[model samples]
Target chain A: MSNNPIGNVWIYIEQDGGAIAPVSLELVCKARELARELKVRTEGVVLGSEIPESLIATLHAYGCDHVFVADDAALKLFSPVPYQKVIVGLAEAHRPNIFLFGATVVGRSLAPRVASRLQAGLTADCTALRIDEFEDKASKRVLKNKLMQIRPAFGGNIIATIVNSWQDPQMVTVREGVMALAEPEEGRKGTVTPVPVALAPEDTAVTIVERFKQPSEVNLKGAQIIVSGGYGVGSKENFRLVYELAETLGAAVGASRAAVDAGWIDHDHQVGQTGVTVRPRCYIACGISGSVQHRAGMSESAKIIAINSDANAPIFSIADYGIVGDLNVVLPKMIRAYRARV
Target chain B: MSLSILVFAKQVPDTANITGQAMKEDGTVNRAALPAIFNPEDLNALELALELRERYGGKVAVCTMGPPAAANILRRALYMGADETILLTDRRFAGADTLATSYALACAARKYGSCDLILCGRQAIDGDTAQVGPQLAEKLDLPQITYVESVEWVRKGRIRAKAQIDGGYEIIEAPTPILLTVLASSNAPRPVGAKRLMQYKKAVTRSELSARHGGRDYEDANLLAAEEEGLRARGLWIYEWGVDDLEADARHFGLAGSPTKVKQIESVVLTGSGTKDVPPTDEGIRDLVHELIEDHILS
Candidate 1:
């Protein structure tokens, strides 16, 4: 509980091979919205073996007031210890009021360790965040300008709004694609502070034996059309119909949590809050009874079509066209009809 | 090289099977209606730890922090060939968030003495936070590898494993005294052997045995010691530890140490106005396809 905050909201900028992740910018934009409410500046902290000049420029364009950077060969790949050292060191000295991270693989691994080192409170996979006043009736007082972190909890339709009133530098890792990515201001400017990286042999114990990048895999976000299946898809053999339809439509295949849990398909295709958040141009859901968490991911698609045997499935609520029939009978009709029309 | 490994497990409400009765009028989960099961990913973690013990000839102990009923997972661990089991149960450790949960777990873990490695699932299904394993590593001051797919080996004071990254994967090498969070896709966990199950069915924690004694505990110290001795002599005693056993500060144990508080639980209301219900027919399918084509959604 330190009252000596630097009056700035800081975001940890994640980069891979000199390219900044889009979630970093989304958080910066969100931080700007939060910072304005608190009357503070939004800044960024980037650590890479090589920080590109364009990456810094992009941060300023996205509304960061300052960018703190530490570049070194030992810090090239993302490791828990070295990354924690850099972020925790900067946080200890600057003492920002709020810190944010992207809910990516790198962000999830690093944020918890940093929070533990600082003894700060951290909320993971936050879908919505805001600044509000808290009425602590038990203590007979009101705490003003607290960060309200909202996320889905206990895996039902339950949504929990969390607050970190007991800890300073309230932290969260924002979900990808949840916040809107604002258009960059192009030529905006900000100040940059270069931090020196001091490392010992103990800090560099882990070495990257190999890194394999697969760019041609299942990319749900970039797809224009998606053919998704759910638990009702039944056996792994029945899932072949979904792949066949996706092939006919030339679209990527998606899955509900049930299909993935049943081991019918790879988890990369899961479309929901726990998985990937996607907004394709057209999303065709088959045998999927959409939960609130599932809807939170793909409800924003340009158009949605749901096919379920149960007429009362929640997926139909947001679907543009709802088919109350078996997908086994309907998916083939959809594929054949589309082929005949083309 | 024999290694000492501790695997962290949790019993979570089966979120996949949420029924209408599971939700209350205020939108909070009616937790009692949901069935609790061993967390799926933690089984993967246990499998990994067991695999290590098979190769390295070390001890694998399973620990879980929850209600007295969480002892169920510890017994299951024994059935799956775990050498030891510990149930960290205390009434004061209720309503703990991830940070306080990790703090109590770290204190409980030290009771097993220093171990070469620690393992747990990437995240629990109930919260999906994935914060405890790494937070525990930070508390223990050990390097951690998260989202691990496979452990190549843990020999000669160093560990090598392949961890899943964003797009693909990366292989890294780290020193001993490390922690790894296992993913679900790692391997198939072995089932409980019938022989082990038949033998260890009598294994009971202090709370469980007391419940069987008409909910009465041994008030005499010698009687309690003799009871424990009889169970241990028959290889049926499961270790149980409370807050005092860990020497944890009262303020840092449960809800007191939790920094984050749930402010509110928002109710969900469906609000889609223009959902067109299509009939199941050939014309209905063809018409929908034509509309999508005309809208430039399809080629």
Candidate 2:
């Protein structure tokens, strides 16, 4: 019914080592648009050991009006308690209208603690964020420009729109790659202010012993074409057909959540609501009976091809081309045919 | 020294294997059509707790907050060798978001007294929010370690565990009275122990006992008390508490405590476009490949 008293739209500028996480910049672009609608300024908060001038500059180029830096050696490592304390302290002092965080492993872990401390509402893994005029039908009152948080409801192909209409400092964690990356305007500037992170001995409870960073082999998001398989593709051995077709086309491979749950493939290549969401140029679905959750991730693909034995499979309904046949028979033929053309 | 480990669990709808009946034509979910299950990851948490108790000569107690029916998961926990179980239930606790849900849990946990450690699944699959465990830690002012894969050891008032990061794993250690949200990859959950299952099969909470007695019409309080007395004497009585038992602030019980509210729910409606079907023939396969190449879809 009432709005938060006074605040600007704020984004948590997440950092790994020295570079700013891409999602933080993405939020900056979105926050700029949102703040413009609300007629407020956009601010960002960065916590790390040594604040980088380039990081602050990059955020400004994307549209942050002001940046708050909490630099301390304790803040260097990503420990839950200390990180939570810094964000909570900053949020309490500023009282932001809306706060955002990346739905990365760190964000998912930290957002809740801060939200709880601030008694703020938090939505996780939001696919869509919007500002809308909400009407409380029961009260017969219209609340203007409430943050509409949208995510997929589990158990079915349903979308739920949640609102933190009753709370101050509405918070939401957005997954990476969900928003378009903003282009930088080199030399763009913003005001930088320092926020002190004072941590108690209790704050640093969990000690990190070591870290071994390994490069991820799968890059489904960057791929132009994806040859994806599903449970209908049958056993792990039969998946060789799908892999062969992908190799022939020089395309990356993906799998449905069901395929990953069945232990036929790893989690990184799984594409759907619970996994990675990809919208490649050409998406070839082999024996994949697409559910609404699966389609939510890839329905925006420029071209779609569906191959399934069941003619009535839901995937065919959205496919640019449909082939009612066995994947085992269809994949080898596709490979052979494409080879002939090459 | 023995360890007192408390495990928090939840009974959630099995959302993974949704059948056609799970959805209504109106696009909203028909929740009754789906089966209620012990949230998978919580089982992993309980398994870890059971193992710790076995190794350290302590007790493993599992707690859950939900409707009266949620006692089902607590019983399931007992079947897996949990020494004790708690069900915190009340109509006032309905419609709680993760924050409010964690509040009720922390209150019930406080009533249950302190333990050396707290364990729970990273998150429930129903919402996949992964908020409750850490939020509960905040409410209790305890330290937390999430995404834990394995516990290396617990000795001299400290627990060492391995937790997963985005690309790698980290070994972390924390003092007693800490919380760890376990991951399913940590260890395979042991199946129900036949001896324990048969032993705890008769266990039921006060609400469940009332149901079995055919509401209040068939029996009076005297008969109910007698039945409960029998259950308690034989260690088959499950602990039950509601909002009043925990002395919770009325504001923090449910919707009033929740900062978030569901504004809208819509079914994903996909409008099919023109679909061209290709014959699975030798000639058709070659022609299709040629068309893709012609369109420059293939480099």
Please tell me which predicted candidate would have the highest lDDT against the true structure: 1
Clashing pairs in 1: none
Candidate 2: chain B TM-score equals: 0.94
Chain A vs native chain A, TM-score per candidate? 0.93, 0.93
Which lDDT tens digits does candidate 2 get at residues B128-184? 899988899989988888999999999898989999877678888888889999997
Residue B297 of model 2, lDDT score: 82
Assign candidate 1 its CAPRI class: medium
Model 1 TM-score (2 dp)? 0.96
What is each candidate's DockQ, to 2 decimals? 0.73, 0.70
Report iRMS (Å) of candidate 1. 1.9
Displacement of the residue A44 alpha carbon in candidate 1, Å:
0.9
Residue lDDT tens for model 1, B1-299: 89999999998898888888888886567888998888989999999999999999999989999999888888888898888888888988888888899999899888778999999999998888899999999888889999999999888899999999988999989998899999999999999989999999889998777777766655555666688789888777888989888967878878878888888888676665799988878899989989999999866
